[model samples]
Target: MTKTVLVTGGNRGIGLAIAKGLIANDRRVIIGARDLASGMEAAETIGAEAVELDVSDRQSIQRCAEYIGPVDILVNNAGVLYDRRVLQNPGDFDVSMATMVHGPFYLIQQFEDHMRKNNFGRIVNMSSEWGSFSEGLLGPNAYGIAKAALNAMTKALSAQLPNNVKINSACPGWVRTGMGGFTAPRSPEEGADTPIWLATLPDDGPTGGFFRDREPLGW
Candidate 1:
């Protein structure tokens, strides 16, 4: 059976690239974007379906889960970089956490049981090197902090999930996306490679780990 893969923020950037890569590999890809029109357009272009998903909102996430039903693979690629400094814009910090950390947490809780029952699941959380303590945990203030928390959650959740259900965090290095800026060294396709690899890991694949370019990275 073809697995249904949901890639959040799939309207553009690395998410869109990931969706395309999955589709090319014969997986059923669903583009989850906050904007229905753009999402639909991207889905149509990629020959996939689109679902409105605003990862910052719990109600939106719940509604999306209900609409899409069970997901075989999940790529938590939706994220945000707040405008102001952590102290300058505390609200933005909340926004950052809501999207990067809390949203993925809710999705995991909502679908983990289903995965457990099926005895198969693959989850890839889009993390950043900025989240790596060994690398200095440096980036936009709120973005770095929120992703560190996300990395922690990935490890915590993996411990409880079934052996067949693999969950791992991936850091797609700076890529040429709207978020990554034009000068980034990598392209979206290059960035998607690692996450796609994690999403399609074999039964013996590693779990509860952080990886970049398919290699383990410091947490």
Candidate 2:
């Protein structure tokens, strides 16, 4: 059976690559983007369905869930990055937090019922290496803090599910994308591997773990 997969912010970047990888694996892919036009174009290119979704908006997330019923896989790939350090401007912190933390939390809540009823699901949160408290990075403080919160959510949800579902976080290292910019070392294709792996995990796979390139990393 073809699994129903939903990837938020999948119109471009690592999300797009992971969506394409799922398509190649014969899964029914749904690409969620804030822009309908771009989302539709991307879905057309990848043979997936497109749904309008702005992760920062709870209503949009609900609408997307209603549009794509009973998703077997949820890839929370929508995140924002503000290049300001924590002390630089405290005002902009909410913007990063809303997208990276609150948005994915809402999405997971909206789909939890479906997952529980189906008795099988995978939840993959696209986190970042900077989110690791051990990483000790200083820049993009808001983004890192929000993602760290997301990682915490991953662990919480994993515990709650305990059976019939797996929840994990994937850190797609700095990849060359519109968000990652040209100076980044890795390509989108390389960055997508980890998320794709988490999204397609088997029943025995690890949950509540942070991973990169298919290997668990220190949190």
Candidate 3:
């Protein structure tokens, strides 16, 4: 049977790239966008299903869980990077945590049981090198802190989840997405490479690990 994959923040950039790639691989792909209209447009254009999902909102996550059907793979690619650090915009920290850390946990809670029942699942948490303590948590406005928490979440849940239910964190590197900007050397497709790989990991694949370019990354 074909697997279904959900890619959050799939209206643009790396998320969109992952969605498109998964569809090309014969997976039933669903793209989640914060705006319903935008999501529908992108889905129609790309041949993937669309859902209105603002991961920061628990109600939105709940609604999606009700309507999106069973998802075999989940790509938690939704995130925001604040231009200013906490000193300039403390609110950025909250938004960062809500979108990247808390939201993903809520999503896992909603989906993990279904995944377990089916005895197969894959979860890809989009993280960053900045999330690594080894790298000094360098992202601005709690971006690194949020991703670090996300990475920690991956590790914590992995310990208890069934062996077939794999979860891992991926860093897309300096890609030229809207967030990464045009000056970045890598393209969105390049950024998506590792995330897509993680999303499609085999039953025996490594779990609760950090990776970039499909190689292990230090926590």
Candidate 4:
């Protein structure tokens, strides 16, 4: 049987590419977008389903869970990196954490039971090397902090998840997407590669680890 996968922020950018790649690989994909219209449009183009999902909103998350009814794979690929950092716009910190950290946490929680029941699941939390403390947390202050927290959550949750339901964090690198900007060296297809790989990991695949291009990286 084909597994069902949900990619948040799947209307565009890295998320969109990931959705497409998975579909090509024969997984049943559901594209989650904050905007229903654009998400449906994207889904049509890719021959997948689309749902209105604002990761920061618990109601939206629950609604998505109800609609999809038991996602075998989840890609917490939704995130925000406002030009304004916490220092520049302190409120932006809340927005950043809500979308990147808190949102994914709740998403995992919402799907935990369903995934557990199936005894098979895959979760890939999109992260960034910019969030790497080993690298000195050199990215935009808020984005860096938010991603670090996400990495922490990935490790913490792995301990509680079923062995068959693996969760791992992935840094897609600098992909040329709306978030990465036009000058970025990597293409969307290239950026989606790692997340796609992690989502389809075999039973022996590693979990609770941070990786880039399929290689382990310091968190």
* Best candidate according to TM-score: 1
Candidate with best lDDT: 1
Instruction: State in Å the error of residue 197, model 4.
Output: 0.3
The lDDT of each candidate is 0.93, 0.87, 0.91, 0.92
Off by over 4 Å in 1: none
RMSD (Cα, Å) for all candidates, in order, is 0.8, 1.4, 1.0, 0.9
Give the TM-score of each candidate. Answer: 0.98, 0.95, 0.97, 0.98
**Evaluation by TM-score, superior candidate among 1 and 2:** 1
Q: What is the lDDT of candidate 1?
A: 0.93
> Model 2: which residue pairs collide?
none
> Candidate 4 residues 95-139, lDDT tens each?
889999999988888887878998899999999999998878877
Error of 2 at 174 (Å): 1.4
**Residue 20 of model 2, lDDT score:** 95
Better of 1 and 2 by lDDT: 1
Deviating ranges (above 4 Å) for candidate 3 = none
Error of 4 at 7 (Å): 0.3
Model 1, residue 167: C-alpha shift (Å): 0.6
lDDT of 1 by residue, 17-95 (tens): 9999999999999998999999999999989999999998889999999999999999999999865779988998888
